[model samples]
Structure formats: C-alpha cells, structure tokens
Target: MRVIIVGAGEVGRSIASNLEQSHDVVVIDRNPDVVEGLTYSLDVLALQGDGTELGTLRAADVAEASLVIACTDSDESNVVVCGAVKTVSDAFTIARVRRRTLLETWEGSQGAFGVDFMVCMDLLTAQAIFRISGLPATQDVDTFVGGLVRMAEFEIGPDSPVVDTTVQEADRYDSLTFAGVFRGEEMIVATGDTLLKAGDRVVVIGSPGSVTDFADDIVTPSAEETDEIVIVGASEIGFQAAREFEEHGYRPRLIEQDHDRAREVAEALPNTLVMESDATDTEFLAREHVDEADVVIAALDGDEKNLLVSLLAHRLGVDRTIAVIENLEYTELFETVGVDVAINPREETAEEIVRFTRAEQTEKVAMLEHDRAEVIEFEVGPDSVLAGEPIAAAATDLPDDVVIGAISRSGDLMTPRGETVIEPGDHVVVFVDAAVLEDVLEAI
Candidate 1:
C-alpha cells in the first residue's frame, strides 16, 4: 500500500517507521531539517512542503496513495490536509486531533472533514492509563477480540511469587499464556523451560480476568485499593481519565490549578472531586493526603510539570505514578526517574492508527519490547495455512521467534499446547519478534 503521511512530527515519523516496512510511505513536512532527518533515519520518502497546500499533495502523488494520515500539531491543519487529500484521492483518510469536540463534530456529521477515521490522542492516552490502573503491576495493556482477550506487560520484582519459577511451573492460569519475556535488552520467546527472573518483563495474553490474575501473582502485590485514584490537572486528559474511572466505580479526585476549569469539570463529572489547587504545592498535597492515594496520575499539559508532579508524588510515598508525556522521547526518561508508567499520547495515537493499516487477517496489533516485538491477534480463515492443522504440525513451519500465545474457539480461550488443533474461525494470538513479522504474516 502507498501511504502519504502529513507532518514529520513524532507521531508522523512513528507511523511512517511502522508502515514503511510493509508499505510504501511518503512523509511531508514544512521544515527542511525535519525532512532531512527523516530521510537520513527512516526508510520512507521525505518531502519538504506544507501538507495543507494542494501543490504539495499533488507533488506527493496523493491520487495513487492507498492511505493518507494527517497528524500536524494544529487540529485545523490536520483536518484541512485530510479534506484536501480526499478531494484528490480515494484513499482512506485518518486525522489526528487533540480536541474531543472536533472528533465529536466529525463523528456527528459522518466524516464531514473527509476523515474516514479520527484519533484523539488525549482520549487514547487516558484510556491506556485507566487500563493500567485496573490491572495490578501492569506497565501496558491492550485489548483484542472484542475485549474477550487482553495483552499485558508486567515487570517482575524480587519478591514476586513467580520470580524463581520456570514458565511451565508458573502456568497455573487456565486461560492465560506466557507470551514472551524481555530480560533487559533481549526478548526471549517463552517456552515451558524458560526461567523467569526477578527483573524480567513478562508479556502475557489471555482473557482479561486470567491476565489480571496472572499479573497479580507474578508481581509484588500492592496494598493500594483500586478505588483510590488521584488525577493531577483537570485538563482534557485528566477529565477523560476521571470519567473512565468513574464509569468503572472509582471515585477519583481531580485537582486543577484553575478555579473556573475545576468548577466546569466538577459540573461535568459529578462523581469526581474537583479540587482547585496547585498540585505542585507540597503543602496542598500534604493537606489532601495525596500520599495515601493508590495511584497518582500526572496529566498536566506540560511534560516538565508532569514530570515534576510525578517526582513529588513518588517522594510523598505514592505507590504508583503514571505521567502523561506529550514528548515521546521522554518516555524512558520518565520511567528512569521513578515514574511507574509513562503514557506518550503521540506514540499511543500512532500505534492505534497503524493497527488500521495492518493486514486484513490481523484483528489487532500491540507494540512490545520497545517496538522490537509485536503481539498480534489474527483470525483463522477457511483458507489459512494453520486452519485444519494441529499446532504441532504448524509449529515446525513457524519462525523460531514466534509463539502462539492463545487460541479462542467458540468463546473458549485456551492456552494452546503443541497438540491443539487450529480450526477455521479460531481467534489466535501470536507473539512475534519484529525481525520475523513478515515471515509470520506470510505463514499465517
């Protein structure tokens, strides 16, 4: 597929990097330096021009493109680019916008801006954080198969019950499968004999309940109750997080520095406590007993402020800290500085958009091991290579780095064994190393 990406920002670059491996990708940016950098770093075509301009789109050959994604920082620019692409091409258009109001308008008008799909970064980031909060000790969480299956990453601590056990010994959950283990920099395709260590980051795929149970058993248990969620900043991200938590029976306290914004959010969310105060103020945090909160989410607008709030919360003895970082480059830095989890809105939005560009057989895709591996959910078609064959027979043809995590048939989720038969219409979850993604796709 030929894909044209507008704006060479973090999200645009990420989308291009992910797509260029399997599709033709062209990236456009107004700045020459960004275009030069992209050309030097990524395997995609980089063009220097304004995406909203007609001449630029024509020069980029939008008419023959299969997909066009507009991800400029300005919502208006992105919408205009998508609309312009639609005027010239029959390609599917995806617009990345930060404002929920714009998304709602487009949805209500049935893609008025010519956007076939829209990604709201703030909402996606908030949803990710909410999911992580619900699952104990999970760094990331993604759902697939209509929410019937889940993929989660958990970091094992020294005190974890499953730290010293082999993968087979720790396979106590009936509906869960140990997908892979990331030990420092190496990703190991987990087998029955794979030894789980204290610092290994393990990825698992299974039903939601089973994954949660496995995570709780493999990671050090937190005494923090699920209901005690504290959100710093009544910004859009914070408000969305509060709304999601409230829907899940959690009464979260939202703190905003602005008095009027706090009042507005309070009115909109009756279940949340809207407090008007500076979260960076130590006295205010102490008075409110923020340390007692189960989770402290730094959803402030600025990355620096969010980092500061996360550090403060951690210093105050908060068990977990989740920071909303706009800059994707700072995700690892935030984690290194003691934040339990760093949510990059741009990265999350890019991943969500890339899922739509995947092969038709792939139901969902989740990035793991810093994009070095992927957990992909695929449905077995009648003509698929694995259909009507036992997993053992197919395992010989599969790549060594790819492991079948779970198989769901007739609403039953199973941790597949070598003798398990893969039939048509079965939902199979596979963990694949990035190096063998294409081979796995071809085999399945």
Candidate 2:
C-alpha cells in the first residue's frame, strides 16, 4: 500500500517511519531542509511542496496512494490537504487537528472536509493525562479490544514490593500478561526469568481489572486518599483535562494566570474551581493549599513553564506531577528531572493516526516506548499461522522478541499460554519488537 503523508513535523515523521517498512510511503513538506533530511534518513520518498496544492498532489501520485494523512501544524492546512486529496484520489484520508470544536464539527457532519478520520491532538493529550493520572504509577496507558483489554506502562518505584523480583514471581495477577520491560535504553521482551528492577518501566497487557490490580500492587501501597486535584494552565489541553476529570466525577481545581481565561473556564466548567493566579508563585500556591493536592498537572503553553510548574508542585509536596510537553525530546528529560509523566500531544496523535492506517487486518495498535515495540490486536484469520495452532508451535515462526500477550474469544479474555490453541476469529493481542512489526503484521 502506498501511503502519502503531508507535513514533515514529528507526527508525520513518526507515521512515515512506522509505515515505511511495510508500505510505499511518501512525505510532503514545505521545508526543503526537512525533505532533504527525510530523503537520506528514511526509505520513503520525500517531496518539497505544499500538500494542499493540486500540483503537489499530482506530483505525489495521490491517485495511486492507499492512504493520505494530513498532519501539518495548521489545522486549516491539514483539513484542506485532506479535502484536496479527496478531489483526486479514492485513498483513505486522515486529518490531525488540535481543536475539539473541529473534531465535533467533523463528527457531526459525518466526516466533513472529505477527511476519512480526524485525530484531535489536544483531546488525545487530555485523555492521556486523565488515564495516566488515574493509575498511581503509570507513565502511559492505552485500551484495546473495546476496553476489554488494557496496556499500561508503569514505573516500578524504588520502594515497590515487586522490585527485585523475577517475572515468574511477579506473575501473580490473573489474566495479566507481562509484555515487555524498558530498562534504561534496552527493550527486554518479558520471560519467566527476566528480573524486575526498580525504575524499570514495565508494559503489561490483559483484562482491565487485572491491569488495574497490577497497578495498585506496583505502588508502595499508599494509604492516603486523594482529596484534591489541581490542573495548572488554561491551555487547550489543560481545559480539556479539567473537563475530563469533571465528567468522571472529580471536581478538579484549575489555576490560570490570565484573568479572562480563568473566568471563561470557570463559566464553562461549573463543577471545576477555576482560579486566576500564577501557579509558580510560592505564596499563591501556599495560600491555596496546593501542597495538599494529591495530583498536580502542568499543562502550561511552554515546555519550560510546564517544567517549572511540575517542579514547584513537587516541591510543594504533591504526590504526582504530570506535565504536558510539546517537544518529544523533552519527555525523558522532564521525567528524569522529577516529573511523574510527560504527555506529548504529537506522539499521541501520531500513534492514533498510525493505528488508523493498519485496518487491513490489524484491529488496533498501541505504540510503546517511542515505537521500540508495539502491542497489536487482530483477529486470527483462517489462513493465519496462529489459527488452529498452539502458541508454542506458532512461536517458532514468530520473531524471538514477540510475546503472545492475550487473546479474546467470543468476548471472553483468554490468557495466551504455550499449550493454548489459537482458533480462527479469536482477537489476539501480541507484543512485537518494532524491528519485526512488519513481518508479524504480515503473518498474523
């Protein structure tokens, strides 16, 4: 399949990189430098031109493309690019926008602007914040198979009870499958003998209840109940996050430095307490008793400001500090410097758009640890290698890094084991190394 992607920003670049090995990928960018860089770095065709122009679409051979993704920085540009693609090609089109209003409008209009699908970056980031904040030690969270299965990345704290235990010993939960572990720069596929060390980010896939149980167990067993939730910033993401918390029965406090923005958010979210004050102000934070808040989220506009707010909240005795970062490079840096979680909107948008491109047979996908590995869900077709075969036999054909995480049959979650026979139509979730993702997707 030929996939044409517009905009050479992080989201577009990420999608191109993930699909280049499996599909014929074309990337269009206005920046000549980015085009030249992608030409040499990736195995995809890179063109220097505006994506919304007819001449550029002709040059990209859009008619032959199977999918076209518009991910430019400007929402208008992305929508226009998708609209332009529809004029020339029958390809599936995806547009990445940052505004919730646009997403709602697109949804209400039944795929308006000729966009086959749309991804809202701010809304996805806000939802990601809510998911990560719900679990105690989670750095990332994604649900698959209609929420029947959950994949979570949790940082094993230094004082956690499961620290220093092997995968065999730590496999105490029912219906949970240890998928992979990220220790420093190494991505270790889970095995019975693999040791669980403190600070290691472990990825697990299983039923939602089991994942939640594992989450609570990995923490040091907190006795203190969460009383207050504070979100710092009235940025698009911050406002959406406050609203998400409110919808889920939490009356969160939102702090915005701008008076007008605070008043608007207060009016919009009646259940939320919107305050106008500088979150970084020590006196203001102290006066408002921000130190007592169990969770503090820094959703400021700038990366520097978010970092400052998260650090300040940490200093003020906040148990968890989540920050929204625009630069993907700052995720590790921010987390290393004491931030609990760094939510990158571009990364989340890229993951969502990339997942849409794999609907041929794959049902869903969750990218892990910056695409070092992936957890994919797909139905076992009649011709699939896993169909009518035990997992132990199927494992021989799969890559060594692959793990049969979990399988669901007839709406029932089935934990994959060596002796378990996978049948046709069974929705199986598998963990695969990114290096062998193309091969796994082809076989499964």
Candidate 3:
C-alpha cells in the first residue's frame, strides 16, 4: 500500500511512522528543516513543498497512494490538501481539523469537502481524560468502549495496605478481578498465592465506578489532599473541564482569547480566574503565575496551539503538562515529542466504535501505536486444543512474540505459570503485536 502524509510536524510524523512500517510512505512539508530531520531520522521519503499545491501532490505521487493523510497544523491547509489529493486520486483521505466552529458549520459536509475522516484533538483528549477520570481510583484508564467497559491500571503505592498480601486476599477487598501484574521487568498472571509487593503495577477490568473505587483504594489507601491544577483554555469544552477541575478542589486559572468572553466565563464559574490571553504567550502564562501550578492542562481547540502552549509549559518546568488532541493519528507523537499526556477524543470515540464492532469476535481489543497493533482477547472454546493444556504446553505451539496474559475460569482468575492448566471455557487475554496478530489468533 502507498501512503502520502502531509505536515511533517508531530502529528504528521506520527502518521508517517505508523504507515511507513508496513507501507510505501512519503511525507511533504513546507519546512525544509522538519522534512530533512524527520525523514533522515525515520528513513522515510521526505519532499519539501506545500501540500495544498497540485504540483507538490504530483511530485509526492499521491495518485498512486492508497491512503492520504493531511496532518498540517492549519485546518484550512489540511482541508485544501485533502481536496487536492481527492481531485487527483480516489484514495481515502483523513484530515486533522481541530476547530469546534468548523465542526458546527461542516456538520455533515466533510465528505463533500473530500475528507473521509476529520480528527479533533482537543475534544478527543478531553474525552479521554473525562473517560479516565470517571474511574478516579484508577491511575490510568483505557476504555475499549465509550464507557460501557474499561481496562484500568493501578499502582500499588507504599501505603496501599494490601502491598504484602497475596493476590487472592487482595481480590477479596473489592469485587474487581486481578487480571495481571507488572513487577519490575516481568509480567505475571495473578494466582492464589502470588504476592503483591509495593510498586507492583496491577491491571484490572470492570465497570467505571467500581474500577475508580478500586484504584483509589490501591493508590491511596488513606485520603489524599487534593492538589491545585491550572487549566488554560476558555472554549466551551474548556469551560466544562474547568468545572470538573474546580469540583476536585483544584485552584484553576482559565485564560481565554478575548476579554469579554473571559469576563462572561468568569461570571459563570466562581473561584476560577478567567483572564484574556493566548496560551502561546509565555509572558502571560508566567505573569498569571501558571509556572507555580501543580499541573497545567492545555485544552486549546487547536492541535498546534495546544502543542505550542504545552511546550512552553514544559520549558517553564511544570510538574505535569497535558494537551488535548482530537486526532488519534498523532498519539505516538506524544511519546516521541516528550509530551506528558496527549488526549484525543475522536481516537477514544473511534476506539469505542471499533470495540463495539469487534466485541463478539474477540474477548477484548486494544489498539496500540495509533490503531496499528491490535491486542486481542479470546476465550478457549470447548473443542479447542488449548483446552486442558498447560501454559508451557501452549508455549510450544504458540509462535514467538506472543504473551498469554491471564486466565479466568468459572469467575476465578489465575496467573498462569508454565504449569498452569487452561481448562475448557477459560477466558484468556493475549498481547499480540501487529506483526503476528493473525498467527496469534489462529493459535488461540
């Protein structure tokens, strides 16, 4: 497959990175520096030019590509690039568009504009945070559904009280099942006598509320004093998020683009300072004393704008810097760019859709590296060879790079060692890298 990516920045680079692994990839950017650096470092073809120009699209050979992605910082540029690509070829086009105003206007006209999919990073990231925060006890929550079910991770801190207890005993505390534990460099499936030591990372799946309560118990056995958090952005979604932060006792300082809008938002939200200034202005951020804040949440409506503000916060050395990204395509770039957290609402929403679509075929599914790698969950059927076999026995049949995470039979969860038996009707979770997903599925 051939893929053409526009915008060599974080989101563009991320899309290129994923597609390049399995396809013929080419990237075009107006900035020569970004093109040279990313292309050389990533070993993908980079062309220097404007994506919206037909000549540039032809130079990149977009006509032969199966997929074309417009990831430029400017929504207008992305739309124009997609329009030009579609005019030249019948390939699928995905555009990164971050403005709510555009969404309200475009409503259902994106197809007419030649865009197959539109990514809104701010709304997506905010939705991700909101979905995770719904399970407040869980340190990190990755939901396969919008909210129907969740996979939550919890850190066993020093004061977790159950730190030294066995997995079985710990399971009795809350009704949540102990799926797996990450200890140091090893992954262990939970067992009756498996000891839960401090610093052990536990994975669990359950309803959102129950998961949050369970996480709260594991992370902070005792009540924790809420810390202050500063959120920058006064957009509608930003205002909604400010309410959530304030409700948690966070000292929130919201900055808007205009004075009148700021005053109006301030009138609606008490105990929150709503001032007027662009988040990209470092002087305004520092003058507002955002540098001293415990955590800075950048909920700007634009991906590039949020990125710039996030970098500023990082440069200023904030304890935490979280940016709202709607584009699921750029998720990996967050890690590569050293951004603490990249939240994508569309990615989260799309995940929910994909999970719903594949719920019956697999026990569970997790999209890794921006949906490039698919983690599948399966239950051993009554007649499958996996039934009644030990983990070691299954290991011999399974190919390399496949890890059997956990087993649950008759509501009892067990960490499978090499000797552990997989009885019929057992539910199991497996981590399958993208390269071997098909073989892994066939083996299970």
Candidate 4:
C-alpha cells in the first residue's frame, strides 16, 4: 500500500521508518533541508512541500495512497491537512494532535476533520504514565480486547531471581503467556526452551490479574508500594494524568507553578490537591513532605526541567520517578541519571498511528521496546492460513518467532496451546518480531 506521511520531524520519520519496510512510504516537509535529509536517511520518497495544500498532496501522489498521516507540529495544521486530503482522495487519514479538547471534539463526532483516526500525543503520554505506574517494574504496558487482555514488558534485572530461568520454568501463571524477549538488538520469541537473561526485556500477555501476578513475582519483593502519586507541573499531560488517577479512585497531589493554571486545575480536579508553587523550590517540596511520596511524575514544560524535577524527587526519597521527555535522545540519559521512566510523546504518537497502517485485519497494535517488536491484535478471516487449522499445524507456515499471546472468541478468553484450533472471526493477540511483521500478518 502506498502511504503518505506529512511532517518530516522525529515523529514523522518514525512512522515512515516503520511503514517503509512493508509498504510504499512517501514523506513530505516544507523545509527543503529536512526533506533532503529524509531522502537519504529513509527509503521513502521525500518531497519538499506544504502538507496543507492540494498541490503538495497531488505531487505526493495522494490519489494512489492508501494511508495519509498528518503529524505536523501544529494541531490545526494537521487537521487542515487531513481535511484537504479528503477533498482529493479516499485514503484513510490520521492526525496527531497535542490538545485534549481537540481529541475530545473529534471523538464526539467521528471523522470530524476528515481524519479517520486521531492520536493525541499528550493524552497518550498521560495514559502511558498511569499504566506504567500501576505495574511494578514494567518497562512498557498496553491493553487489548477491550481491556480483558494486557501486554506488559518487564526488564529482567540483574538482581531478579528469574534471570537465568527458562520461559516455561518461570511462567507458572495459568492465564499468562510469555510472548517475546528482547536482548539488546535481538528479538527472541518466547518458547519453553527460551531462557530469560538479566538485561532482557520480556513481554507477557494474559488476564490482567495474571499479568500483574507475574510482574509482582519478577520484581524485588521489597519494591515500594505506590500509595502516593505526586505530579509536578500543570502541563496538559500532567493534568490528564492527575485526572486519570482521580477517575481510578486515587486522590493524587498536583503541583503547578502558575497561580492561574493551578486554580483552574484545582477547580476541574476536585479530587486532586493542586498546590501553587514552583516545583523546583526545594524548600516548598520539603515543607509539603514530598519525600514520603511513593511515585513522582515530572511533566514540566521543558525536557530539562522535567529531568531536574525527576532528579529532585528521586533525591527527596521518592520510590519512583517518571518524566516526560520531549527529545527522544534524552530518554536514555534521563533514565541513566536517576529517572525511573522516561515517556516520549513523539514515540507514543508514532505507535498509535502505525497500527492503522498495518494489514486490514489488524484490530489493534502495541509497540514494545521502541518498535523492535510488536504485540498486535487481529481478527482471523476464513481465508487466513491459520483459520480452521490447529495452531501446531499452522505453526510451520508462520515465522518461527511468532508467539500467539492470547485469543478471544465469542466473549470468552482462550489460552492457546499446540492443539488449539484457530477458527474464523477469532481475535488473536500475537507477539511478533518487527522484522517479520508483514510476513506474519500476511499468513494470519
């Protein structure tokens, strides 16, 4: 399928790279330099043009495109790009937005901006923070099948007891399936013989309870319990995060430096205690007893500021520190210095938009370890190679590393085994190496 992507920035480049391996990808940017850089860096065709204009869209061959993604920095620009695309072609359009209100508006009226789907970056970051906070020692977390199934990635720490244990030996949960293991640059599909390494990030999928049970067992028994959540800054992501916690029965504390913003958030979030003060004020943090908080999230306006806040909270004795880092390059630096987790909005936006570009049967997708592998949910069609065949018999036709994580059929969950027969219309969640994603998707 021919795919056209607007905005050749980090997020746009990420989407282009993901789709380039399996589909026809074209990237557009107004900056001639950026377009030229992409021309050399990625295999996609790079065009120098404004995405909001019809002439530019036509030059990119929009008529023959199957998907168009509007990911310019400006939300208004992205919506307008999608709107402009609709005037010319019937390609599926997706827009990446930063504001919650815009997302809510589009959600209230599906396809409001000629966009078939919308990915809200800040909102996705907030949701990711909440999910990672709920799980213990998780590197990543995502849900599928209307929340009935959960996929989690946990790094096997050097101190973990299961570091050297094989997948089947450590996986004793009845409903949990070891999906895949990421060891540096290699992705190993989970199997009875696959051994868990200390630095490996292991992916698992199953019932939420079973996944949580597995998480609890792999982490240190003395891991701090998340009883208190402190959010620094009143940025949109921070506000949404506090709201998310409140909706889940958590009365979290929010600290905002701006008086007006703090007051507004306080009014909107009655359950959250909004404190108007500089988050970097060490004296204020001490006075508020921030040292006793279990989890501290830094969502300040600047990446460096968030890093400072996260480091400060870590020094204040917070058990965990999560920071929103805008620049992708700083994610590793922040984590290495002291922050427990670093959330990148661009990466999250790319993950959300790439799912729609997959095969027609793909229902949902969750990228793990920065897209080195993916856990994808897809419906089995009658024409599928796996349909009406035992999983063991069909296994020979699929990529050797593909792991069927979970299956849902007729409102019931099934733990797939060698003898399990895959029928039509069944929603199967599979963990596959990104190298063979197209191969697996085509076979299924």
Best by lDDT: 2
Clash pairs (backbone) in predicted model 2: none
- Candidate 2, TM-score vs. the true structure? 0.97
Candidate 3 deviant stretches above 4 angstroms:
137-139, 145-148, 164-169, 173-201, 206-210, 224-237, 240-258, 264-444
Better candidate number, 3 or 4, judged by TM-score: 4
Q: What ranges in model 1 sit over 4 Å off? A: 221-225
lDDT, candidate 3, equals 0.67
* Candidate lDDT values, in order: 0.88, 0.92, 0.67, 0.90
lDDT of 1: 0.88
Instruction: Give per-residue CA lDDT, model 2, range 323-442, as digits (tens).
Output: 999999999999999998988999999998888888876999888889999989999999898989899998888889999988999999999889999999999998899999988877
Residue 192 lDDT (model 2): 89
Pitting candidate 1 against candidate 4, the one with the higher TM-score is 1
lDDT of 1 by residue, 228-263 (tens): 899999889999999999988889999999988999
From the highest lDDT down, the ranking of the candidates is 2, 4, 1, 3
The better candidate by TM-score, 1 or 3, is 1
RMSD of 1: 1.5
